[model samples]
Every structure is written in structure tokens, then in C-alpha cells.
Target: MADPILSVRDLVTYFRPEEGVVRAVDGASFDLYPGGTLGIVGESGCGKSVTARSILRIVDRPGEVESGEILLRRDDGGIVDLAKIDPRRREMRAIRGGDIGYVFQEPMSSLSAFYTIGNQLMEAVRLHRAVTTKEARQRAVELLQLVGIPRPEQRVDAYSFELSGGLRQRVMIALALAAEPRILIADEPTTALDVTTQAQILDLIRRIQDERRLAVILITHDMGVIAEMADTVAVMYLGKVVESGPVDAIFHAPRHPYTQALLRSIPSVLAEPRSRLATIAGSIPHPYARPEGCPFHPRCARSIAGVCDRTVPVVTKLDERHEVRCVLYGRPAEAAE
Candidate 1:
């Protein structure tokens, strides 16, 4: 396996609201290689988006990365800890859009209403690359064409409101690629799109990854999307990853109770006609009132009565490249003696 271009370990991001601390990302860890896709999946409020934002140091105020190592392998073959850097520093700002490109969930909200697509793309291009206005505009047209937008020459001048949802998404991709960054963090890029458009966007991402060997961090709640696009999968519950492994391992041989429940919940064509889809019993625990022990214990059918409700489960290795945080697989700390 290639050395990880990005590695996160024991990441803990907290939101200190007046009420309490929201542990948005607690002990989340993962690695992304140069040309592979890592899918982070969970229900809404499970911290998938927060994990991505934390990596780029773009978490909104009142929410800060409390502790962790965000290691980034730079172009010069040196390693830097992104978590330690001052996010407002020029170097960190350059790293934000220069080395890593982020495609947000909603194109309509992310793109400015007053600016043309060309203007937005040009801003991205010039910010990273020393290019004149005319050159940046030319690059914008090329980017639109690269992302498979129709009539790149004309659509370059169109505002976000002038385009369809699918087109707006394509423009978002163009803007993310405007800097030619090595890594792309796509947070629910297919949200609100029709199934057809969803497939197209996924395909475009795959094609671009193949062409550029770009590493991708795809954050979504859709397991089907993860199965289709991710090389590896990380199943997050509450704020921590409960299961992680190769996509095949996660889908065919999931170990954690939460992972199993998630896979079972996926609606399938092979299911009995008119049968109800399986659903996880309860909603994720509220961040302020998070349960002790395994965070998923309340909803996990397989949770042990006394053990899972009180003691936190440590990570247990299942096999090479596969791991889970559940007592079902992990030996107790004393048992290791």
C-alpha cells in the first residue's frame, strides 16, 4: 500500500456552546492514500462533515479542534501537522484551497449569488496560481469543460441561479479543481440531486480521480454511495468511528453491531416484495447527553448488558486493514494480560 498522503489520529473536535460541549469528532482516525477514496458514513449529526472541516481548520467559531494529529505529506516530501498550525496563517490558508480542495454539500448556498461562475472559478485559480485575469478566465473555461459542463464558453458567465442543480454541482466541481489540488473533500456532493444526476456526479468524481490520481475524502450518509465509490469505509456513530475496513469487508462481513445494522437498513432489490426495510432502533444520542461506554450501546442490539453500558471499548484489529471499536471483537484490557 502507498504511504498515506493524509493521516488523522485520535481527533477530537468540540463545540463549546452555553449548554455543553458537543463532542463533534472524538478519537476519529483514518488514512487517505494518494489515489484512493475513503468514505466516511453515518447518520446526520454523526460528525462526518465536522471531521472534514476539522482537517482543513475551517470549523466555525465556538467549535474548535481540541486535540489530534492531522498529518499532511507535503509536495516536498516533508510532513506537517495541520492541527498545530495557526489556521489564519498564510501557509495554512494556502494549504486550505491550494493543496486541498473542498466541494461543499450545497452549491446554491456555497456559490455567491452576485458572482458569475467564471468569476468564482477565476478567484480560485488566481489564489493558488500566479495567473493574470485573462489567463484565469481561460482556465475557468477549461475547468468547466473538464467537469463536463455543457457550453462552457457561455455558461462561464451564468450565475448559480441560472443553472440547474446538476449544473450547479458541476460548477462546484470546476471551482474545487480550479486550483488543481491533490486532495478533494466532497461533503454530500450529491445531496438533493436526482438519481440520474447523482450517478453522473459520482462518475465524474471517479473519472477525475483516475486521471489525476487524486485522493478523495467522500463524506456521505448513503451506504450505497460508499459501496459504489469508496475503496475503504469508515462507519461513524455519534462522533467516533465504530468500524473501518475495505469496502468489501465492510459490506460483506461487517463486525460491529452498528455497521451490521446500517447494512441491514439499506433497502435492497432482492428483498421480499412490499416488505419493510430494517431500521436501526433508536436515533443517535444527543451530543450533550451522550451515553457512556460504547456510544451505540443504547441502539446496538448486540450490546452486552453491563459491559457495553459502562466501559468504553477500545479499538480491536480484525485483520490487516480492518478494525472495529466494539467489545464483540476486542479483548478486555485485563484479558490482554
Candidate 2:
């Protein structure tokens, strides 16, 4: 079997606050194969953004990656442990934008207000490449065109405030691609845009991924977006990965009750009008008030006898690539008996 481009094993990220510690990412693990797209879906505060930040080792202060191994496949076929690598190391510096690009959720905040869009793109190119200023500017123009920016030369000199939301997002994509990274981590890149713009951005991401053979980590709460873009999906709840599998499996044959509930809640086109959307019974328990047994047991519709409450269920595999950390179907036979 071919090796994955990125593999995360038993990741745990916690935030220490005056209030208390919040386990933003607890024991989350997944793999990203070359040229693959992995979608992470969950509600806000479910650790979707933190998981992305943890992989890049940019967790904010008061938050620390307590444990885990993030293995990155190097060009020489070597595996580099990202967790152990120091933030100041030259290798990590090279890894951030050179190997992995990021498209942030809010284009307005992410882009500098003072700098022109062209200047940002040129700076990105110049940082990663040993090129003359003129050459870098040309590459920047090409990137804008590649991202479907209309009249790239004219938009190049525009400031963040001068561009529309969609145009700003395109510029963000253009900047992310400046280094020609192998992986793109898009953290809810389309959330703020209208429906039409959101579709355009999704289409743009697909085209870029196909063109570059990039590994994409798409983080969003919209299951519809995941169903459209993801080859595989991971469902996170209370910092833990409750279920993960092929998009089809998770969408059609979801094993965990949470996964089922989430899918049911998405408004369907074919369903009868006035049909109420199905909602999970209770809210996600607070980080400090996490339930003792299964964090999800309190809200799970299919809570099993003595399993969801007494013991934390282990992740059990339904097949080679599909697994769920729930008590229903993916539990040990001994426990099942």
C-alpha cells in the first residue's frame, strides 16, 4: 500500500485558562494521502479549527499540544515528526508555506489592510523563492489569473478594502498558492460568502486541487459542502472524533448516533415541505462539564447498556478505512456480549 502524505496519531491539544482547561482536540487521528481531500465536519467549538491549527503547530498561547505524532512524508521518502520539531527550526519554517498552504475563513482579517494584494502575493513568492523583484511580480500576476481573478493586472494594486468579498477570497487563494504548497488547509474558507460565491469558491478549490494534486483539509460545519468536496469525512464532537469513514459511508450508513442525527438535521430537497429538520436532543456539553462516561452518551439516542456510561468506548474498525469511536456497532465483541 502507498504511504500517506500526512498521518496524525493520537493528537491531544488542550487550552489552559483561568476558568479551566479545555480539551480542544483530544485523541484525534487521521491520515491524508497524496492528492486527497479530507473533510472535517462538526458544529462550532467542536475542535475542527483547533485540529487544523494543531497539525501546523500554531496553537495559540495557553494552548499546548500535550501529545501526538504528526508525520509528514518528506521528498526523500522520510517521515518527519512535526510535533517534536521546534517552531524555530528552519525545516518548520520551510514546511509552513512551502509545503503546506492555508486559506483562512475571514479574508478581511487575514489580509493586511495597508498592503496591496499584489504586494502580499509578491512577498509570499519572494519569501519561498530566490527570484528578482520583477520576476516575483510576474509570478504574482500569473497566480491571480490562475485563481480566476478578473483583470489580474488591475486588481494587483488594489487594497483589501477595494475588493469585493468574492474577489478578496480569490486573492486569498492566490496568496496561498504563491508558494506552490503540496497541501492546502482551508478553514471554513467559504462561510462568509453568499450561496453563489460559496459555490464559486468550492469550484475554484476543486480546480486548484486537481491542477496541483494537492492534499486538502476542508474544515466546515456544512455537511452539504462535505458531501460535495470530500472523498473522506471525520465527524468531531467534544474534541473527540466520534466517527470517520468514506464520505459515502458516513453520509449513507452512519453508525454513530451523533453522525446519524447530524445528517438528519441537514435540510433535504426531496423531503416533504414543512417537514421539520431533525435536531439532536441536547446541546454539546460544556468543555468543563464533560460527562464522565462517553462524552456523547448523555445526548446519544442509541445509548447501549452499561457501555456508553461505564466505559469509554474504543475506536473499532468496520473496514480497512472506516472506523467509529462509539458503543453501538464499532465495539469489541467481548464488550458486545
Candidate 3:
């Protein structure tokens, strides 16, 4: 395997409000290698988006990355901890768009309504590359074409509202790629699109990854998307990864109760017609009132009585590359000792 382009270690992002501290992302960790896709899947508010924002140092006001390291391998063969950098510094700003590009979920809100798509793209290009306006405009057109927008010359001058939802998404992707980033963090890239458009967008992302050999961190709640795009999978719940392994391992042999329930919830084509999909019991606990010990224990069917409720289960290695944070996998080994 190639060296990891980005590595997140024991990340802890928190929001401190009048109510109390909300641990949005607690001890999340993962690695993204060159040309590889790492899928982060979980329910909403499970810290998937927070994890991505933390990497770019864009965890909005009132929320901050409280601990851990976000290491990015530079072109000069040196590694820098992004978490330690001052977010207001020019270097950090350069790193945001130059090294790591972000494709947000909503294009309409993310793209400026006042500016033409061409202008937005050119602004991003000029920010990272010292280019004349004419050159930036040319580059912007090229990007628009690259992302499969039709008649780039005409569409480039159109405002965000002028394009359809699918087109807007493609423009957002082009904007993110304008700087030629090493990593692309796409949060729910196919959120609101129809099935046909979703497939097209996913195909486009796959093609781009193959062509550019870019490392991608794709954050989504869709398991089907994960199976289609991810080489490795990380299943998050209550801000922590309950399972991590190869995509096949996760889909075929999920270990964590949360992971199992998630897979079960995905409707299968072979299932009895008109059958309802299985659902995991209980809602995600409120951040301020998080359950003690294992966060998923309250809803976990395989949870041990005294052991799971009283003590936090450490990550247990299931295989060479597979791991699960559950007592069901950990208790037997301890009992044998």
C-alpha cells in the first residue's frame, strides 16, 4: 500500500455551549492513502461531518478540535500536524484549498449566489495559483469541462440558481478540484439527487479518482454508496468508530452490533416483496446526556450485562485489518486468562 496522504489519530472535537460540552467527535481515527477511498458511514449527527471539518480546521465557531493530531504528508516529503496550526495563519489557509479540497453536501448554499460559476472557480484557482485573470478563467472552463458540465463556455457564466441541482453539484466538485488538491473530502456528494443523477455523480467521482489518483474521504450514510466507492470502511456511532475494516469484511461480516443493525436496515432486493426494512432500536443519545461506558450499549443486542454497562470495551483486533470496539469480541479472551 502507498503511504497515507492523511492520518487522523485519536481526534477529539468538541462544542462548548451554555448547556455543556458536546463531544461531537470523540477519539475518531482513520488514514487515507494516495488514490484510495475511505468511507465514513454513520447516522446523522454521528460526527461524520464533524470529522471532515476537523481535518480542514473548519469546525465552526463555538466548536473546536480539542485534541489529537491531523497529519498531512506534504509534497516536500515532510509531515505537518494540521491540528496544531493556527487556523488564522496564511499557511493554514493555503492548506485548506491547496492541499485538501472540500465538496460540501449542499451546492446551492455553498456556491455564491451573487457570482457566476466561472468567477467562483477562478477565485479558487487564483487563490492557490498565481495566475492572471485570463489564465484563471481558462483554467476554470477546463475544470467545468472536467467535471462533465455541458457547454462549459456558456454554463461558466451562469449563476448558481441558473443551473439544475445535478449541475450545481458538478460545479461544486469542479470548484473543489480547481486547486488540484491531494485529498478531496466529499460530504454526502449525492444527497438530494435522483437515483440516475446519483449514479452519474458517483461514476464521475470514481473516474476522477482513477485519473488523478487522489485520496478521497467520502462521508455518507448510504451503505450502497460505501460498497460502490470505498476500499476501506469505518462505521461510526456516537462519535466513535465501532467497526473498521475492508469494505467486503464490513458488509459480509460486520462485528459490532451497530454495524450489524445498519447492514440489516438496508433493504435487500432479494427480500420478500413489500417487507419493511429492519431498524436499529433507539435514537442517537443527546450529546450532553451520552450513555456511560459503551455509548452503543443501550441499543446493542449483544451487549454483556455487568461488563458492557460498567466498563468501556477497548478495540479488539478481529483479523489482520479488521477491528471492532465491542465486549462480545473482547470478553472471551479475558475470561481465558
Steric clash pairs (candidate 3): none
Q: Rate the local accuracy (lDDT) of all candidates.
A: 0.92, 0.89, 0.91
| Model 2 stretches astray by more than 4 angstroms | 330-337
* All models, RMSD in angstroms: 1.2, 1.7, 1.8
Q: Tell how far residue 213 is off in model 3, in angstroms.
A: 0.4
- Once fitted onto the true fold, the runs of candidate 3 whose alpha carbons sit more than 4 angstroms away are 331-337
Best by lDDT: 1
Give the lDDT of residue 266 in candidate 2: 91
Clashing pairs in 2: none
TM-score ranking, high to low: 1, 3, 2
lDDT of 2 by residue, 1-337 (tens): 4688999898999999999989999999998888999999998889999989887888888998889999999878989988898866888878888888989899878899989988999999998999999999899899999999989888888898999898899899988889999899999999989999999999999999999999999999999999999998999988888899999999989998889999999998998998888998989888888887688889887887577777777898999989998766666444655
lDDT of 1 by residue, 88-182 (tens): 99989898878899999997778999999899999999999998999999999999999999999999999999999999999998888888889
**True-vs-predicted CA distance for residue 335, candidate 2, Å:** 6.7
lDDT of 3 at 220: 98
* TM-score (all chains, Cα) for each model: 0.98, 0.96, 0.97
Give the distance in Å from residue 21's predicted Cα in candidate 2 to where it truly belongs.
0.8
Error of 2 at 97 (Å): 0.8
How much does candidate 2 score in TM-score? 0.96
